[model samples]
Each structure stands twice: as structure tokens, then as C-alpha cells.
Target: MEINIFEIAKSSPSGSAAVTFMSYTMMENLLKPDFFNTSNDTIKTMMSTVISATLPKTNYTKLTKPVNFTLKHIREFDHSGSLSCVYWNISEWIVDGCAVLETNSSYTVCSCVHLSTFALIMQTRGPQKSDPPLELLNLVCVIVGLVFFTLALLTFALCQWSPGVNNVARINICISLLLAHLLLLLTQKFLNLIRPQQVLCAVISGLLHFLFLSGFVWMFIEAVLLFICVKNLSQISSKKREVLSSGFLCVIGYVVALVVVCVSVGLVPEGYGSEHCWIKIDQGFIWSFLGPVCVILAVSSEYKHFHMGC
Candidate 1:
């Protein structure tokens, strides 16, 4: 058998020689065409030449088609054969085109284009199943928290019997804590129903942190006041002094909480949870909350011992 490889050069001067040889080999295997026929050789040679000429240098390009077929049967093709042919042509085109682009460039373009196209395709497609919608969960939590808070508030308000100064301070602190939790829960519920507005989320998160910290500080103050009252039972009897002390402590708490929360959010805006943003405890958990709690407990214990001794 004799082959005129020079004919491929005449037909496809720009073609990759290697590609032409590979295609010819493939065609030979499939057709087993008789090389004795000049016409058959010429046809095979031309087809191989054309394919080589079109072959790309780099094997990278974005695939524009969706992974799944989104088009309706009627819209896609009038006949089944036509649809099959179209899909085959599309596949070949993607394979050839992808060979030309740089790998990284192709990947980035493919990802971005696919994402954009997928969004459009999804619009035409139906709603997808998501884990029991967040709205439902948030709604349940908000309702429950609100109900609990309302009942708690009413109970606190309706109780007319005056409590001791320390007890009154503790009640106020509890009320603040409950209110903070309620606000945090309500904000979270709203966030679930709607896409978060960054500014609003930040403000609400900051407020939540402030309130929570303030509540903690108030609790600490109540502990301190109780300790002082027990230790100096005779000297700390003035109602005005007691009220002034509580007020002063509250002011200090607010200031301290504001400073801490501001620093935290400023440094890392989303460091904490979405529901109740605060300084992340894990990083410096001991100093943030545990240290203060320990100090308060120690003070209270010492005061109790001193009083017992007296």
C-alpha cells in the first residue's frame, strides 16, 4: 500500500502534522477503507487535514452549556435526530475550543460563566429543596423567646413588694439580660426571612453585644453590692447611698461594655455569631468572662466569712 502524505500538506498548510496522522489512523481502524482507491485516500486525507487545521494549541476553554438539559423538547428541536446531532456538535465544539485556552484562565472563566448561567438556568428551573427553611426555625424561636420575655417582664413589673437594694439591683440586671436576649432573638428571626443588609446586621450585632456585656457587668455589680452590704451592715444603711452606688456601677458598666465591644467589632467585624455578636470567647475566654466571675465569687465568699466571724 502507498500513501501520498504530501496531499495533507497542500490541503491544510496550518494543520498540526501529528493530529492529521492520528485522525487518519482512527479513520483507518473504523472504515478499513481500501487504500487502492485514490478517491477514498483523497477524501480521508482531506477530512484528517481539516481536523488538524482546526486543532487548538492549548486545551483549555470554558464550557457554556449547562450540565443538565434545561430546554424543553419542542424548543430544543423539531425532530429527535436534529436534537441528537446538535448535542453531538456541541460536545465536539466544546472539546476543540477547550484545547486553546490556558488552564488557569479557562478554569476561572468556566467557573464564573457557569455560575452566572446556572443562576439563569435555575430561574427557569423549579425551586430546589433546602434544609427546612431557616425562616421556619427563626419564627419558632422568636415566638417562644418573645412569649417568655413578655411573661417575665410582666411578672417583674407587677410585683409591688419592695426588694432589698441588692435584690432590686439583681432584678434590674435580670430584666436587662432578658431584654437583650429578646432583641437578639428577634433580629435573628428577621435575618432568616430576609437577606441580611450589612449595615443593619452590624448595628444590631453591635447592640446585642453591648447589651449582653452590660447585663454581665450589672450582675457583677450586684454581687459586689451584696458583698459590701453584708460586710458593712451598719454603715451602708443609707438608701440614697445604695441607689447612688447602683447608678454609678451601671454607668461604669455601660462605658466598659461600649469600649470592649467597639474594640472587638472594629478589629474583626464578624468574629462572633450572627445572632448575638460579641468578642469571641475562645480566643481569651478566661479573662473576658471567667476572671470577673471568679473575682466576684471570691469577694462574696470573703464578705460572708467576715460577717460570720463578727
Candidate 2:
């Protein structure tokens, strides 16, 4: 498919001569089309291959004039349902920066101000299901866990410890996990309200991403400390302990996670929020959270095993 990017040369300030416009079609199986309540009204859908248009640089997203695309219909046509031009927002198809210019049985023309994976979908109403008892069970479990986390944190804070005991990592891990779980629970509980406010939903997701990852970082920190303490107490002298101060631990715990979330946002801002107000699974943005978690799990497990062996 050809795109009408009239000012692409202007969009790219490199002033270098450009020769080609990049475009690709993705297989339908690449994305899951499970529309999870992205609409209370009729939802439009069409089984079509995903299309991405790109220039030399990323600034093609915002333009002086919108880009026009002639998306040929690849699905069987139904006259009864209406179709709309949409771009995948990682979680679902949305028409935020797109509009349908023209359509027919065989093709539809779409005009979008920003560039993204664009497609056409037909409008159809569908039934929804709710299991209140199951939701109540989930809520109860989260609340119980939160209560225990709070109690543990308080115990760490109020109780006196032996002179050599270090609770820095434990305390921070508790805080991070507690906040992360609390934010996630609240996000799900009031998702209906949060979903409509896209900015808030994105912010909540980013915070959850950072908080949860920070908790994992702290867990890794605690595991390393345990390993070090057990493996060789003599290696970490009082001077070395002074170097590995609480402040240094806190930096490693929270800053590392903050940097990750920031970089993820820089790479793909839309990856943060979705219909459910979490990381989007379509663009593999979920890996921003999962990648670190998996690494921490492997490294932490190794540390624990070594500590046990020692």
C-alpha cells in the first residue's frame, strides 16, 4: 500500500536525500483481536492484515498534513455493519488520530494525523459477562495480603534489631511490593472509571511498572546480601559495609526501576496503558516488565542456591 506523506522531506530535518518509504504488512495471527470492552456501544472489527508506514526518522507521527492510506479490504464484506479506520494502541484498535475518508465493498480510505499500525474494522454488538463472586474473592485476597505486608513493614520499623542486622533491603522491598500491589488492585477495582481517562490510566500503569520492578530489584538486592553474608563475612569488612550504605542500596533499589520505566516510556509511550490499564501485550511492551522480572528471578534463584550451599 502507498501512503500520501506530502511533507515527509520537511518532517525529516536531516536535509539528506531520501529514496524510499518503508511499509510492511503483518500476519493476522501477530495480534490477538480479543476486544475487552473497548466499547459499550457497537464495536467495529474487520479481519485484515496490520500495516505500518514509516519514514527515515520517527517524527513522521506528527505532521503538517495528515497521511492518507488506501487500505484494501481483505475480508468478506457485510453491508449491515459499519466499518471505521483505526490504529492499534497496543491493547486495542482506536480512532484517536484517524478518520475514515471513503469506503466501498473492496477498499477503504483512511486519513490519520499520526502514523501507527492502521486497519479497518466493522461495527457489531456483542454480549459481556461479569462474575461478581470471583471478583469479590480476588479483592479479599489482595486486601489480606496488603494487611500482612503493612504489618511486616511496621514490625521492621518499630522493633529494635541486633547491632549487625540489616533491614534496609527488606523494608524497601516491602514498600515497593505493597505500593505496586495496592496500585494494581485499585486500578482493577475502579478500572471502569480509569479507562475513560486515558492519561490517568497510562500514569497508573507506568507507576505500577516502576513499583513492581523496584520490588523485584529489592528482592535481588536482599538475595545478594544474604549470599554475601553467608558466603564470606570476612570479605565484606566494616569499611565495605559502610560503602554499601542504606543510601546506596536505596539508589540501586528504586533508581534502577525508575530508569527502566523511563526508558520504556521513551521507547514506546503507548505501551504503558491499555483497556485494562496495564502494559499492553500486543506490541510486546509487556516484555519491558517481564524481561527484568525474568532476569531477576534467574539471578536471585542462583544467589539463593549459592547461599544455601554455603
Candidate 3:
């Protein structure tokens, strides 16, 4: 650390007064309750201890000339983390008079106009420790579900049921749900690579929203059809058929989801991606996806009383 006396020395020179340097490694616990603004990321000090350098005789708050400080990194450096030159300011740590000059994996050089207790802080986007078992479980479950979904879709396509039975809703349900689950698993597995690319993350999140919603819509349609079939089995064998046409059912299956996603995008353009590759929770943006899901579920649960006129 370089401490140069500029105008302060010219006005009231410290002369031969010695500058004292002290490391408060043991006293770090006392200063642990800090008010550093690090958003949501986990924070850690680069060095194991805090250092204090002060001019014993002549004390100054602001210096006329900028000084430089080199803080060595004690822990392993992370490429995805951010580093800052911060100092104790009363009850908190801030970088008001300090700026990062040069940085490397080993150490960082900080240029500041004034000095106090100084240290280097690092912030990383991920948690300190992750549960490997939970992650493995999720991966295994999603893969198995995807395999079953694919098999169901293939069966629907190849197997021919009785002409009296309609499989339009079931087919669409399998197709949309399979695609949605696959996309979700892929996005999560590659989240680290995709999150940095803002535009790509946003697009993927929007696609996921549409696919999942479409799946829900198809499921609700199929549930309503099942209810009708269970209640009116004798009329199901009509030659001309009693239900809506396949084309109309197909359109309704996806159109509702598309419309909701379009409106959500129009209302909050920046709410597509966030901490995860999904709708951000900020500004009630998550409600857009949740609202439709809740509506579909509520309606489906009460489908027994609803008349389909089929």
C-alpha cells in the first residue's frame, strides 16, 4: 500500500511521524456485522483478515493524491465471481473513494483517494454448497418421465383405437407435455451456459412458458372429454360423431396458451428470464404463468358439473 501526503502534508506536515500497520485477523468477528450491499449473491472476503494502516500523528479523511493498495487473494479465485475494493465506513463497508485499478487471480490493486480499514470482497452467483443427491434425483426422474412420454406419444401415433373413441386431446397432451418436459430438462442442465446470454435465455424461457401452458390446456381438454365419455357412453357411437371436430380441438388446445404468453410478453417484456431460465418473480411476472395454470386446474377439478354439449 502506498500512502502519499499531498496537500495535507503541505499544510500540516506529519514530518517524522511513523505510519502504523496492523492486521486485525482475530478481531474480524467484531466487525462481521457489516452493511455491504451485495444483492442476492453469496459474499466472502478475499483475504482471511482485514488490515488497517493509519498515520499516527497526522490523520486525514481525503487525500489530494490517490494512493494504491494491493490486496492478495487468500482463497481460490473464481472466474464467475466479482471483486471489489471496499473499506470500512462507520457501520458499513463501501467503495466510495476506492476504485479497482488492476486485478488478477492472485491479487488486486486498488486506487483510492482516502484510506481506512481496507479489504477485498468477492461475490459468487451460486450457493456455497449444493446437494448432489437432490440433483441426481431430479436428473433421473426427468429422464424417466421423458422416456415414458415419448413411448406414450409413439403408441398414440401407431395404435389405432376404436373409431367411436377420439384421441385428439390425448395425442396433443402427450406431444406438448413431452416437448415441454424435454425443454425444461435441457434448459436446466445447461443453465450456466445460457443464463449469461440474455437474449437466448429470454427466448428459451418464453418457449418454455408456451409449451408448458399448452400442455396444461391439452390436459384439461382431455379431462373434459373423459368426463363426457364416462357420462354418455351410449351416444358415443354416433356415425357423424357428437363432439367438436379434430381441427377445432387442435386449435383450442394450443391457442389459449399462445394467447396468454403473448399478452404476458406484451405487458412485461423484461420478465421472461431471471435467477432461473423461467419467468422472473419481480413485478408479479410469475403470476402470468401461475394464473393460467391455476385457472386450468380449478376448471378441470369442477369439470363434472360443466356441460360440454358433446
Candidate 4:
């Protein structure tokens, strides 16, 4: 029932510490001369010793002190005799001579090693729940955006209804935003699944970036067209030029965005964990999309009011 304690050392700059401890029964088992110098026959004798020590008459209850150890210095330990040794933080500590009685019935010692290591790594490196919740909300936004977009596109294409040039441009802006939301949805979904394939992750990320950039470019075009219609009514007649220019700009923007995303994030697929496959929107990615749209909206708003004044 009693436990013994021994201190090894302080761990590192991290200030963690290591210690060793053993139960009385385990210490007695280790004291046996043949405990370490064991063949198959010797092991059978040790097993018998352990079984005899664990009998009801022995009544060994627990250890006197809990072993404390840092994870940094754990090396291999001997688990071979009446006493099982656990090595942690470069120190070996013994448990009970009959500790097999306390061991989980399902897991062998070897299997426990692999499973415990896997669980520890996952706990340290896995995604936070906070962002995933926001991603789920974004997904819902994308679905709603798609529905509105489809309705708007259908109205524009199929219905004879013609809103004014400005209104039509606004509709285009809505459609572009909708497409952006859809791309966002798809990117978030793929990230959630945690697929392990590198090539597939890169392709999906590239497509999402391309689509997102195109959506913003289209929005800018809509704004510019609206501005021209309001402030420079004469220039509105050059709709053919406007359409051609917008098409060229959209293509160029998407190509550039795709190239950059592929080069940066796509090239290194393994650095970040499975949760993140795409280029994060930290360095000018937001500006690349939002900046142009903001400018277009500002110009369009000013032009619309100016025409109203006239």
C-alpha cells in the first residue's frame, strides 16, 4: 500500500520537473537478483512472484506519493518482470509488482503506447471550435446567397423586365456577391472534411481563390458601369467597350489571383495541418477583393446622386 518517491531533475527552460516512484511490492520485486537477468523460465518465476504478491492476504493498497514527470525527456523503460518500469523525462519509475491487476483489460502495453501518442499530438495541434462555428454560419450564408443569385440571374435572363441601367448593374453586383459566397461555402466545406490528399487540396484551394477573385472583379465592373450610366450618360452608349473591358479585367484578375495562391499555398501542402488547405486572407487577399469593390461602390454612389441633382 505504501509508495516511495524520488526526484530526477528540473526539465528545461520550460521549468517542468521529473520524478520517480515505486510501490513497496514493486520495489521488492525489483530487488530480486534475477528480475533483470531473465530468460523465459525466469519470467515465469517473476510472474509467479507477482501473482503471489497480489493475493488478498498481502492487502497492498496504494502508493505514498504520486509520480510527477515532464513529457520532454521521456525515453524507453523496461516493462519486463514482476515490476513494470515506466520511463518519463529520462527517468524510470516502477509501479506495482502486480500492476497488471490495475492495467486496463483491453489494451496491451504496446498498443497503449501508439494510441496515447496519437491522442496527445491531436490534442495539441487540432483546429479550434471557435472558427469552425463561424465557418458553419458562412456556409449557411453561401446557400442563401446562391438562392438569391439564381433568382436574380433567372430574372435577368428569362424575364422581359428591364430595370434601369443602374438597377441592372446593382443586380450584377448582387450576383457577383452571391458567387463569392458560394466559393466561400465550398472552401469551408472542403476544409472541414480534413482530407489528406495534397494534390486535391491544392486544386480545390486554387479554384476557390480563382472564383473569389472573379466575383470581386465582376462587382467592380458593375459599379463602374453604374457610375458611367449616372455621371457620364454619354459614355453609357459605349456599352460594348465596357462589356469587353470588364471581361478582360475579370479574366486577368482571376489568373493573377490563382497564380499567386497556387504558388504560395499550393506549393507547400504539408506545413499547415489538415484543417487549412487554402491561402489565408491575411496579406492583401481581402484588399484584392474588397478594395476594388469599395472604390466602385463609392464612385457609383457619388455619380448617382450627382445625376439626381441635375
Task: Identify the leading candidate in terms of lDDT.
Answer: 3
Tens-digit per-residue lDDT, 94-199, candidate 4? 2322222232212212111100001000001233456767767876777877898888877765665444433443455456566656755665666655446655
* RMSD of every prediction: 17.5, 14.2, 9.9, 16.0
**Backbone clash count, each prediction separately:** 4, 5, 0, 5
Ranking of predictions according to TM-score: 2, 3, 1, 4
Q: What lDDT score goes with residue 283 in model 2?
A: 68
* lDDT, each prediction: 0.43, 0.76, 0.77, 0.42
Off by over 4 Å in 2: 1-42, 45-128, 304-310
**lDDT per residue as tens, model 1, 206-254:** 6776776777766667666766665655555665465546567667767
lDDT for residue 71 in candidate 2, whole number 0-100: 76
lDDT by residue (tens digit), candidate 3, 1-310 = 7776545556554444445677776655666524566656576555436788776666544566787878777776654467778888888878798888988878889887765787777776654365799989999999999999989988887787776567888888888888888988998899889877878988989998998899899988888677766676555535224256788788899889999999999988888877567888867889999999999999876665555543
Question: Can you write out model 2's per-residue Cα lDDT over 27-71, one digit (the tens) per residue?
Answer: 445543444235457654664566776554444345567878887
Which clashing pairs does model 3 show? none
TM-scores vs. true structure, each candidate: 0.44, 0.62, 0.60, 0.43
Worst 10 residues of 4 by lDDT: 114-123
**For candidate 3, which ten residues in a row score worst on lDDT?**
234-243
Q: Give the residue spans of candidate 3 off by over 4 A.
A: 1-128, 233-243, 306-310
lDDT-best of 3 and 4 = 3
Return the lDDT, model 4, position 59. Answer: 26
**Best-to-worst ranking by lDDT:** 3, 2, 1, 4
How close to the true structure is residue 173 of candidate 2, measured as C-alpha lDDT? 82
